[model samples]
Each structure stands twice: as structure tokens, then as C-alpha cells.
Target: MSQKPRRQKHPKPPKNWQPPPDDKGTILVRRELDEYGLNIYEFRVLAHVARRESKAEGCYASQAKMAEVCGISQRTVLQALKTLCQAGILRKEKNEKGRTNIYRLNEGSKWKHPSELEKIRKAEESQEDELLNLI
Candidate 1:
């Protein structure tokens, strides 16, 4: 009997990504944790949440589940989750049963990407210069 290869929980994207046939959308998130200056663990949790979410609906995963996948304790997961929340990258809702919390990416958040920092800085400088001129 031949054994089949086990499925990976997290699979890397292919070298060349081709759009889906129907163009519904792609959910393959292989983003680096530091893309937005986020901590690695926190971003891992964020990625996990994003993986489970759909464009139409925000999704939730249990702390235990995240911990199990990330090889960390529930406490660590919670801490990382909280960090993401405070950074405006994630929003959490307590489940009614109190088993675990539901998390979703705050995609509408004011949090700017690293690439936007320079543009924001320049804007602020211009604004300050205008203010100085008025003064």
C-alpha cells in the first residue's frame, strides 16, 4: 500500500500566482509579520484570523485553536491578540458561550502601511510649515 502525502495546515503560495478562474477572490495570505511593524506572534494570529475570514464576513477562531496552530500557549495567543487589537489591526468579540473570542481584521482601521509612512510624514511636514507661515 502506498501512503499519500499529508495535507499542510499552511501552504505557501506558488512561485507564480494566477488569478482564480471565476475571479471571486484570493485568500492566500502569506504576508510578513513586519509588513506593518507588527510583532511576529501578533501577525501570526492576524494571518490565522484572515485565513479564516471571508470578504463578506469577519470570522472568528478560538484561542486554543490559534495556540495549537502556532505552537504557543493560550495565554500567549491572548496576549498577541490583545496587542493586535491595540494596534488597530484586529477587533475581538466575546462569544456568548464564553468558550473563545471571535477576531476580525480591522481592515477599515486608520492604521497605515509602512509604505504610507513617508507620504504621511511629508504631508504632516507640509501642514506644519503652512501653520508656521500663518503664525
Candidate 2:
């Protein structure tokens, strides 16, 4: 007796299928995020994560998936995620059962503008210079 082929849990899209137009399906990244001093990889990864967010599940894409979609290396994705999290622009929660992380974009208020970061950098540099002078 011949066995039947198994069915896919999720069917693949047709060869000719195309994504919806920008107006129909859009990812909204606030303009202020641009002033947050994010590098190119960080920006791209953040945008991709935002694109994957949903009202029900939030973003749970693996680093490999993020790298694949963002056209970046997994290590680069990891670094970008770390920077974003440190900057308070994104929050990451561990999924115990899934063994993956869920990402959420924090409110704009939590992010620091580039000018603030520059000020902090200058302050630290001046402190370093003072320490060196004493030494």
C-alpha cells in the first residue's frame, strides 16, 4: 500500500504572489528614531522588527531570521539588538517555552536624542582628559 503525502501546516504562497503595496501594508517607525543615533544595521534591524510586530504576538523573530530579512550577519543583528536595548529604544523579553526573545519598541520618550548622547560623550571625554592630566 502507498502512503499519502503529508500536508503543510501553512501553505506556501503562489509563485506570482507579491506583497501588498506600501500604502496598504506599512511599517511605522517614528521620524524621531532617526535622531536617536542608530547606525545603519541598527536602523534596519529595528525597522524589520517593527514590521514583524503584531497586536497579538509582538515581534518574536529569531536572530537568524532577522539577519536574513535585514540582509545582515547574525552577529551584526545581535550587536544592533544590544545597542537598541541599551538605548531604551527596544525592549526584549525572554520566551521560556519558545527559547526565543520577543522584542517591543519602547515609547519615544524613552529614547535619547543624538544631541543628548553627544553631550554625554563630551562630558566623559573631558573627565578622561582631566584624569590623564593628573596622571
User: How many clashes does each candidate structure show, in the order listed?
Assistant: 0, 0
lDDT per residue (tens digit) for residues 81-106 in model 1: 76666556677776676666677777
- Top model number, lDDT: 2
Estimate the lDDT of model 1. Answer: 0.66
| lDDT (CA) per prediction | 0.66, 0.76
Candidate 2 RMSD to the correct structure: 13.7
In candidate 1, how many Å is residue 109 off?
A: 3.6
RMSD of each: 15.0, 13.7
Q: How large an RMSD does model 1 have?
A: 15.0
Over all chains combined, what TM-score does candidate 2 have?
0.66
Pairs that collide, model 2: none
Candidate 2 lDDT tens digits, 1-135: 999996523323457988778794465555677557777888889888888888667799999888776777887888778767767778999877698899998887887666665465456568768989999
List where candidate 1 sits over 4 angstroms from the true fold.
1-34, 55-57, 112-135
